[model samples]
Target: MAVTCDLSAERFVDRWSDYVGAPPLTCGIVDVGERTRPTVSGVDPDRVRTVSDPGNLQHLHDAVETHLSELPDADRTVVYLDTVNALLDHVPIPSVTGFLDRLTSSLSALGAVSCASFETGERGERTIRPVTETFGTVFELGRLGRSLEPTDDQLSSDDVFEVLSSRSQRLVLRSLLRAEGTLHVRELAQRIAAAQTTEQPDIEQIVTRLHHIDLPKLRETGLVAVEDRVVSATEVVTEVEPYLALAHPDERN
Candidate 1:
């Protein structure tokens, strides 16, 4: 079952087909909104259930719950929520998050795979930060592909400067570049402190800061990736590396 907030059921199926190949014949679309939009030619009308108002969360939940109760193979089912951004316009973050938490819990108990999409932007990011904690796994898909790596045209000079402004961040990029793009947090922290000529580096403190601040900023900019206490540099870091010196000219001398 899929709950679509941003696009019509047919459009969502079209995107799903494009991304993951043709959706199953058993696929169900719980489209949220009116039927003013024309349906696609090939999509099945019986498979789609629409709630006229996007703000009608109860109706949407009832639609999905009714669908779930009828499913014979719960394990084969996949629940998709194509976006939370549109819903946020109608409901508060807490309500949307609460609904998601409940839905995901129910889906998990049924052995169903749950997937959701949330757009990224200043406002979207604020909502996603908290919502992300609800899901067990999160995948970030860029405009091009699964890689969060931004293309040259996507990143401007100021964007690069903003990311590389911190001395610790610059050092991190340099170290990752030298290490062939991957290092454990402890090793990465040691390398960072070593570059600063710290004789007695507090490794734990450095690691804590990286976990909380530096790594997240770099990951957000697509300059690096952090997973399981390991940090890896992305192509963006290598591409904008020369500008690192210019970002902090004092570091050069």
Candidate 2:
């Protein structure tokens, strides 16, 4: 059985680089459906590859296989299968379950491991439950987002201090920095709440504190800003990109 894990692209790439004793590996983002694919800026254009219409399982498998083949034996490969939810949308519960069964089997055959991160409304939670129960690992990226750090080189002592000064602030900052944007506090809270597998104190209160207090301090440092209820990272690429490039370089290219 393969180990399944969920992490943001930053954390995943960082760990893979460490595990292989290599610089950062490039990633390819494939849109498995026919829609406007979301864009992730600052990601190297040369490093990214894409596949359209992965709704067809054979096409999905072939794309993944070809991508994996291109990597050096020592390099780790990650397939960001966006819209696992979108893929299942409108399908009957039993049909969705059957699809996952086949998808996992196919992935295993390709020597690839797969994991998914998604939001859960009560209705979505019902469908997600069985998938988690069956899969050995289920990670909540929003909750886990709080604990993640950019590669050491990517962050400075001031950055660490700024983040650690307040727990509420830290959580907000970490989430925005990871996503490369400001987010509504309510959304941030929901994400953090989900990532936490264990029960906790009032999450709403926590978010309130972050919005009132922590966010102000972060803004003073020019690390974050808020317009209305939304908060976004400030000058993140200027602060972290060089360090990321240094920490994870492409040897082949």
Candidate No. with top lDDT: 1
Off by over 4 Å in 1: 19-23, 36-44, 148-253
1-253 per-residue lDDT for model 1 (tens digits): 7787788877877877899787656767787876764464455566667788877777777788777767669888988888888888888988888878888877778788788888766476667778886875556556775643455535556667777677888888878877889999999998888877568878888899899989988888888888888898887674566566455534443
RMSD of each: 12.5, 16.1
lDDT of each: 0.76, 0.53
- Measure candidate 2: CA RMSD: 16.1
How many clashes in each structure? 0, 3
Off by over 4 Å in 2: 1-24, 35-51, 122-126, 140-253
Which residue pairs come into collision in candidate 1?
Answer: none
Worst 10 residues of 1 by lDDT: 244-253
Per the 3 Å backbone cut-off, how many clashing residue pairs does candidate 1 have?
Answer: 0
What TM-scores do the predictions have? 0.54, 0.37
